[model samples]
Target: MTNLSGLQASRPPEAVYIHIPFCTNKCFYCDFNSYVLKDQPVMDYLRALEQEMELTVRDNPPGVIRSIFVGGGTPTVLKPEEMEYFLKTVRTYFPNWAEDIEFSMEANPGTTDPDKLAVMKAGGVNRVSFGVQAFQNELLSGIGRIHNTDDVYRSLDNARAAGLTNLSIDLMFGLPNQTVDMLGESIKRALALGLPHYSIYSLKVEENTLFHTLFNKNQLPLPTEEDELAMYLLLMSSMEEAGYGQYEISNFAKPGMESRHNITYWRNQDYYGLGAGAHGYARRMRHINVKGVSPYIEATKNGLPRLNAYPVTQEEAMEDFMMVGLRMREGVTGEAFRKQFGRQLEDVFGRPLQKMLSAGLLEHEGGNYRLSRQGILFGNDVFGEFVGVLTEI
Candidate 1:
């Protein structure tokens, strides 16, 4: 309610993103700021995370934290007691939790067990998302995924037995040695799980990732761009057929099971980003923490572990609104744009909107601008139009 200044808070972030940067093994395609758990100081890093929370709330007091997403190399790698400590810090620092909070943790199938899942449930984690990249053992092994199809079933069973039902799984297409048929099988099995949510993505080779290294040498077997597009089409249709709503780009859910935490990002709202390499947006300021684990811990020892913090310009904010909001199925509303920036949506982005609308890449209905079926395929192009268009407005 109040900050250290003893006055009412100017703005309190209601969403939280905590990063756990340790994993059993680094996936070939993962470039996220994570380290192998082997010789790393796990508990020490967690303690630093708690200290960061204390320092964060001191200046930027929190409102009701409605969603907390613990993401990582693999959050499930944490021991049960470690998880308990982390959640306790979360509760202690941000006590004003919303009644229907959606607390989620990302798990790698082999890393999760009954005891750890039980710790998660007891700590208010109502949702669990497993990285079940594919159902086929060969495909799973072709990539660097250590968990086979069996780990997926066993993990789901343990999660269910722990009384956690709001489950989701992730699938990736365009992987090395993967076929469209393989993808379809993965989708079928995912749907058969009867879980409430699924996230399907196409593999992207980013710098510093093993996939990137292999790609440069033409050693990585990849689907052709056309094939990748086909995979996306299949993913969308399959999810819709399974009665799951494609709420955002790469995410589908059974109606109310949509990820509220992610919606906060798409809506361009504020949230606290805790832990190493986590990014936060609040009070029109976007900041990311130091990327290295030991460096992050050392940085937080004195104060906030900010690698870089900057205030967002009004133009950038408006551009961000369009870029992120358009990812949602409901898309961007004229009303929301007007409310956030006190400018008419058309006034700020008239040229891009007109172009997209004319090209049939976007559709305007009831004064909202949403991507057309075609626009979703060229989402980056559609977003690119709005990127710098606001600067001159």
Candidate 2:
């Protein structure tokens, strides 16, 4: 453990994200930094994680961590004792958490147990986000998910019984053979649980995934672009009618129940990412840990884990700020931009901003710039302009 107080006295992060890269099976459309394991060195991974945290805090001890998110290869897959050890390591390094720190962990439907949930809560985890991709059993199997619909309900019940009040469910749309009615039913079933937050992501066929191979071969039956767009609109309208606010492009939440940790990412705030394939940004530097468990564990013995690190340039940071901040419904604040870059937002990317405004993709209101409903639908076009500006400069 390092003297974190002195290290972070000048600059403290508002959030922290830990990645767990081990999962029982990988999903069809998934391309995250995770691995399927037959014989995993779980203990070695935990020790490497501890060493990484020590070195991370020494370099950048985050101040009053407002949110901490443990995501990935099903964080709940760890046995109860291993989970405790992991959580204990977290507390050991960054001891100064915010009074209202939103500690969240991503759990799969069937992996959660009453005892494990209890341990997580006891270890200061207040929120649990279940990766219940869909409510239909057939869809779950098609996506390579081991959990069924019954598992989702039982997991929620167990979480509630464990005294974890804040709950969220992840839902996916535009699946193989999925209808609008089926998507609606999934949302309906999720709402019935009264979860505070819901993450609805459209399926994308990424490289090296089963879905990608099937898609390339024309074997995967996917919805058309129009159908996918319709699904997005339906989800937006339904969530709005159900009293959930579209805080981010893929995230909806009841008032004040947004995933604080995720907000850190969308806001372009600095956080420590500690785990295999995890990414971190702090002191204007971005780093990604090695993706393989064995490699990361072996590298940690040298005190600093094997990581690919780089310093973010001023221009790149501003571009990232716009790219990520615009994802939020509130958009990017002019004041924040100026504060981070010491220049007016207009002066920085004046031409591109004007073009977006002229095209009705962006609107200026309340000293912030946000996307119009049209822009949200065609957000890629709006974001492309910024990317173009970055490339030119």
Clashes of each: 0, 1
**Whole-model lDDT per candidate:** 0.90, 0.87
Task: Give stretches of model 1 more than 4 Å off.
Answer: 1-9
User: What TM-score would each prediction reach against the true structure?
Assistant: 0.97, 0.96
Q: Write the per-residue lDDT of candidate 2 for residues 1-393, one digit (tens) a residue.
A: 111122322466777889888888998888998878568999889999999899878876667788899999889999999999999999999888889999999999989999899889989999999999888899989999999999999999999999998999999999998888889899889988888899999888899999999999999999888888998999999999999999998999999999889888887878888888888887777888888889989888887664788877777777888999999999998898876767689887889889999999999997799989888998878887887475575
Name the TM-score of candidate 2.
Answer: 0.96
Task: Give the TM-score comparing model 1 with the true structure, all chains together.
Answer: 0.97
- Candidate 1, clashing residue pairs? none
Measured by lDDT, the strongest candidate is 1
Candidate 1, residue 230: how far the Cα is off, in Å: 1.3
